[model samples]
Target: MAKDIPAVAAGNQVRSVAKALMILNLLAEHQREMSLGEIAKEMQLAKSTVYGLLATLRDFGYLEQSPEDGKYRLGTRLFVLGNVVADSWDVRKVAAPFIQSLVDELGETVHLVVLDKGEVLYIDKRECTKSLRIVSQVGTRLPAHCTGVGKVFLANLPAEEVKSIISTKGLSRYTKNTITEFHLLEEELKQVRQQGYAIDNEEIMESLRCVAVPLRDYTGNVCAAISVSGTLSRFEGDELESIVSLMVRIGREISLHLGYRA
Candidate 1:
C-alpha cells in the first residue's frame, strides 16, 4: 500500500506543513545534504517558503544544518526514530544467536537485513573468524539494487512499487559488476523471486560474493533477508551452492521463530 502523506491544511491553517514534509521526504530520498535553494527548486516552492520551513524543522531538531557547507540533512530525531523501530522488532533478538552460529559454522560474515522504505537496513551482523574478511557493520544502509539482501527484498515488492523505487532511487554503480540498468535489475529480481534467493556477485564491493534468502512472516510476507558474505576466492560452484542452501534453511528457521508458518 502507498503511504499517505498527511493532508495539507486548508484556509487559515495553510501553514505549508505538507510542503515541509515533501521537502523532508525529498531530502530523505536523496540521502544527502541539500542546500536551501536546491530544496526549494526540487520542491517547487518559493525560496522564502523553503527557508521558513527549514528553519522551523531545524529549530525542532528534525533537521540539522551542516557548518561546513550550510546544507541541511536529517537530524537526531531520525536516529532516535530508527533506533525505536529497530528495537521494536522481536525478530532481531530471535535471529541474533542463529546469525552468530552461521558465522561460526561457515567462517564468513552473516547479516540480517530488513527493508526500510526503499533502502535495506542491516539490523544484525556477525563477523567470521577468518583473518581476512568482508566487513559489513550493523546499521549500514545500502541501495537495494546493489546488495543481495536488498535484491531479495526488492524481488518480493509489488511491480509498481519496484518501478517506483527504481525510478526514484536510481541504479547507482558501486562497482564494475553492479547492475546499473533498470531493465537488467528487473530481470535479476524476477530470477531471484523464482529461485527464492539472490546473489551479489561483487556488485557492492570488488572481489566479494554473497548469497541471501528472504525471511517470510506469519502472513508469508517477505519481511527480511539473511545473507552470508565473503571473499570471492572462498565461494564458487558447490561451495557457493552450499552457502545458498544454508542461508535458505537458516532464513526459514528464523522466519518460523518469528511466527511464520510456511
Candidate 2:
C-alpha cells in the first residue's frame, strides 16, 4: 500500500501557489474590481488567506483599494506592463518604410495588422495619395472573415482553433459580399493557404477591395499580415495583380526582418 503524505509536509505549498494563481486569473478575467468577500467566495479560499494575498498584492501595487467602496481592483502596474508590451511591438519602426514605399509605388492605402483573439487589430496604416479615401484607424478591430488581413491570419490557424473562434464569435455579415457561412469561410481559407494571399472583395464595405499576405515569425508561423486596400473601381485585373504582388513582397520583407525564415 502507498503511504499518504502529510499536507503541510508535501502538497500544501503547491496547492497554495495554485490557489493564488487562480485568484489572480479570476481577477484578470473579471477585469479586476471585486469585494474581499466576493473574491474569497469565488476562489473558494479561506477569508484569512484571501486577505493576506490581497494585502501582499496591494503592497506590490498590483492591486488597489477602491476609494468609494473599498473593493479591490487592478492597479497602475498592469498599465505599465501593457505599455511595455506595446512598446516592444514597435511595428511602425520596421513596417513604416515599407508601407511608405508601397503607397508611393502603388498609390494605395497600406495596413499592418495582428490577430488578437478573434479580431484583426490594426497596428499601422498608410493612406493613399488619391483624393478618394477608405478610412481605417490604427486601433480599429474588425471581423476576421470579412477583411483581407483577417482572412490571411485565419487561414494560417489550426482547424480546431478556427472552428472554436467561429463558434464563439459568430460570422456576422458586414456587407452583402461577406462570407458568413462557416463551411464557405473554411473553403475560402483553404484557397488562401494554397494561393499564399487573400482578397477582400468588398466584404467589409461596399465598393472597397483589398489584398493581403501573411507575415510570418521565426518559427515560420503566420503571426501578422500586411494589406493594400482601395476602391474596387481603382483595383481591377492587371492593376489588382500588381498590387497583390507588391503586398506579398513587402510582407515577406517585413517578416524576414522580424526573423522569419521561408
Candidate 3:
C-alpha cells in the first residue's frame, strides 16, 4: 500500500527517522563536541532514547565519541561526504585559475580562505616557484583576527556578531604583531572596512607580509578572501601597493565569476 508513494512511511518509522536527522542537525549546528546528556537535554529527549540513537549512529560511523572526554562529534564519514558535496560547488575550483595567475605574475604564495567559526580555513594555495612562500597547508586553520584574509571577511560582519565571535574564540597572541586587545582589533577592522582591503604586517610570522581582498557572492555577501603572501623585503613600500592593487583587481574578477555582479 505504501509502495506507490515513496515518501510515505508509518508514523513510528517517520518519527524515528526525524529524531535521527535532528541529532545530525544538532551536531552540525554546534561548534564544539557534545555529550550524550547534553544532546538529550537540548533536544528534550530521554537519556536512554538519545543514547540508543547516538550509539546506533556512532556504530554506523555517522558520529564519533571521544574516549578522553566522552564528547560526541560528527565523524570522518560526514567529512568524506562533505568533501564530495564541497567539490561539486567549490569556490576553489572557480578561483584556481585566477589564483595560479596571481602566483605566476607575482611569484609569491597565494591563498584562498573562508571563515569557519571565527577562524580562517585555507581552501586553496598556489605556491611560488621561486621558493619564497609561506609554509601554510591547504586545510590549515588559523585565527581569523591574525590574518589579512580573515580580517577582510571579519570586516564584513556586524559589530555585535564580531564581538560575539571574538568572545567565543578569544584574542590569543601568536606574535608581538598579533593584536590581542578587542578595542585595538576593532579599530583595525574599522580601517579595513573603510579601505576595502586588509594587510597582515608580519603578524602570523615575523617579516612575512600579506595583502588580502574580499570575494563576494551573487548576493554581494563576502564569501571568501584571496591573499598573496611573501617576505617583507620583497614587499616593501611601492611593491606592496602594486601587489595590493593587482590582488584586489584579480579578486574582483574571481568574485564576478562566482556570480557577483559588482
Candidate 4:
C-alpha cells in the first residue's frame, strides 16, 4: 500500500478550492453582510481575482447583495441546497403528513412551492376531492407577484431585489385584483413580511383565494412555502382569517420538523 498523505499535504492539494471555502467560512463567521473590499482585504487577495470569485458565487445564488449597504450576505440558495443535502431526512416526506392533514381539514387543494429565479415552482400538490377544485400540476411555474406562495418567497428578499424582479417581470395582470402597480405591490409586500404570510385574494384566479405561509429551514430562511387555494365563497369574512391561522400553524410545525429550532 502507498504511504498515507500528511494532513497538511492532503489539505494543500486543492489550494484554490480551499481558499474559496475559506472565504465562505469567513462570510459565515461574520454573521452579517460584507462589502467586496471587506472580503478581499480579509482574504488578502487581488481585487479583480476576488471580484471574479464573488461574481461566480453570486451568480450561483450562494451569495446575494444587500440593497441597503451593497454588501454581500448568504443567499436563499444556500438554504435550498442545504435542504437538498438533508434529503435523507427529506422535507417532502416530513411535510406530507401535515399537508395531507390540512387538505382533509380544509377540504381544499394544498401546494408546496419553491422560489426559482424569482418565480414559484410547484413541487408537490395534495389534491382535494371537490369537483370545482383548482387544477395546478406539479412542476408548474408561475409569476411570483400575483400568487400567494410566490409572495411569501418575495417578501423575504431585499427591497431592491424585489423591485428589480418586479420591474423585470412586470406584473402582467391575471385579474383586476392583482397588484399591478409597483407602489401598491410594495405596500402589500411590506405587510406580508411583517405578517409572515400572504394572501392571493382572487388575484391569480377570479373567485379563487389562497393563503400561503413560509416554510423555513434551520437558518430561519424561507426555503419554500405551503399554500391553500380554493373558491371565494369558502374564504369569506371570518373563514379567511381562520384558514390563514391554520396554515400558519401548520407552516411553523413543518418548519420545526425541518430542523428549525424556533
Candidate 5:
C-alpha cells in the first residue's frame, strides 16, 4: 500500500547502515587493505552496493583508499575515535589498582599521565604518607620537557612531532637541571629510548626525583606513562635501581591489561 512507502524506506536505510558496519568489521578482521571487488565478493553484495558504502565511509574519513593499489584500509579518524573511547573506559580503570599498589609498596607518590597538546596531562595520582608531597594535582598540565612521565611520552613520539612540540612549547627552565637546549633534549630522549625509562633529577622541582616507564596499548604504541616520585635522598644507589625495576614490571602489567602483548 502507499502508506507502507515510508516504512520501507526506513528499513532500507537501516540495511545500508548494517552493511556499512559489516564492511568496517571485515576490514578489521582481515587487518589488511581490501579492494572493492574483494569486499563485494566477500560480503556477497553487488559491486555497486559496496561501492556506495565505501564511498560514504571514505568521504567521512572512516576509511582510506590507497592511490597506488586502489585498496581500502582503516583511516586515522577511526584511531582518533578509538582513543576517545579508550580514554573514557580503558586506561584509567585498568591502571588504578596497579597505581595504588605502587604507592603502597614504594611508600612514595605515583602519577599516571598522557601527552596532550604538547603538554603532560596528569590523569591520576596516588599519594603516600610521606611528609613531603608532589605539588602537582590530577587534571593539571605540566611542561613535557621537565617531568619524568612527560619525558617518557615525548621520547616515544616521532622526532618531527617532538620538534614541533618544542617549537610551540618552548623549553622554559624550571630548575638548573632542566634541559633548555634542543640538542641536549634530543640526546636525553635518545637515552630514554635506549634505556627503556626516563628520570627527572630535580628538573621540575628542586630535590625531587622521579623514575618513569612508558605504558603501551594493544597496538604496542606508547599511549601513556607512569612515574614514581620522591625526594632526592630516597632515590639513590641501590634504592633507585629497585624502584626502576619495580615500576617497569608494574608498567608492563598495566599495559597487558590494556591488551599490550610485549
Candidate 6:
C-alpha cells in the first residue's frame, strides 16, 4: 500500500520534518513538559499530526514522555549532543581568526587569556608589525587586578570570590597606575561591569595601554577575555574610542562562534 504523503513544493523541504523541528523548538521555548493537546494547540495543528511527530521524536531519544503525566520534554540525547558541541569549542581555535583580524586592522598586539586559579593566564598572542611591541607571551601569568583582561574576568566573579582572589594575589603594584587598594580595585571592577570593558591604563607596564572585553560561552558565562595592546601614543586621543568599539564587536563575534547567544 502506497502512502499518500503530499510532496512539499518549496525547495524540497519536507513538511513533516519542518513540523517536527517546530515541535522541538516549541518545547524548548516553553522549557517544560507539554501534553500532546497542548503541543497541538500551540503548534496550530491537529492532535493526530502532533501526536505522530511527538511519538517519532520520543522513539528517537530526542524527547521523553513521562509515565506519570504523559507530558513530553526534552531528552538526554540533546544533552549528549550539547556536550559534543562544548567539547569541540577550543577557545584558542575558535578565537584565532578574530584575533588576527584585530591585529591586522588595528596594528596592535592582541591577546587571549583565561582566569586560572584567580590569575590571568595568557593562552594566545598575536603581534602587530610595529617595531615597538608589548612584551607579553603565551603561558605568562599576571595579577588579575592590574591587567585589562584580568579585570574583565574578575568583574564577572562573585564578590566573595573576588575578595578571595585579592587575598591570595595581594594586588601587587607594578606601576603607579596599578590599583593597590582593595576598595579602589572594587570600584574599578564595578566600572568594568558597568562599561562592558576594561582598560590597563599603564597599570602593568608604563606607556603600555590595553583595552579588553569578555568572551562568553553558550551558558552566557564569561569564559575568557581578549585585548588589544599598544603604546599610550597608539591608544591616545580619537584612536582610543575606535579601538574600544572594534574590540567589543570582535569579542561578540568570537563569543557567538563559541555558542553564546547574546
Best-performing candidate as measured by lDDT:
5
lDDT comparison, 1 vs 5, better candidate: 5
Model 3 Cα lDDT, one tens digit per residue, 1-262: 1122124344434665577778888888896799988988887888898898899889989999999998999988888987887687558789989999898898889999999988999988888779475678978899888899989988999999899889999988877999999999999999999988999998888989899999999999999999999888988889988998998899899999989996
Worst 10 residues of 3 by lDDT: 1-10
Please tell me which predicted candidate would have the highest TM-score against the true structure.
Answer: 3
TM-score per prediction, in order, is: 0.70, 0.69, 0.71, 0.66, 0.67, 0.66
In order, what is each prediction's RMSD in angstroms? 5.6, 6.3, 7.9, 14.1, 15.2, 16.6
> lDDT tens digits, residues 178-206, model 6?
99999998999999999999999999998
Clashing pairs in 3: none
Compared with the true structure, model 5 gives a TM-score of 0.67
**Model 1 regions more than 4 Å off:** 1-85
On the 0 to 100 scale, the lDDT of residue 73 in model 3 is 94
Q: Would you list the rank order by lDDT, best first?
A: 5, 6, 3, 1, 4, 2
Clashes of each: 0, 0, 0, 0, 0, 0
Worst lDDT window (10 residues) for model 6? 1-10
Q: At residue 139, what lDDT does model 5 achieve?
A: 72
lDDT (C-alpha, whole model) for all candidates: 0.86, 0.83, 0.87, 0.85, 0.90, 0.89
Model 4 bad stretches (over 4 Å): 1-89
- lDDT per residue, candidate 2, 112-219, as tens digits? 899998999998888765824866787788989899998998899999999988898889988899999998999999999998999999999999999999988788
Candidate 3 lDDT for residue 96: 89
Q: For candidate 1, write residues 104-123 as lDDT tens digits.
A: 89988888998998999888
Q: Candidate 4: lDDT of 11?
A: 59
User: Which residue pairs collide, candidate 6?
Assistant: none
Residue 2's C-alpha lDDT in candidate 4?
Answer: 9
lDDT of the structure predicted as candidate 1:
0.86
Error of 4 at 38 (Å): 51
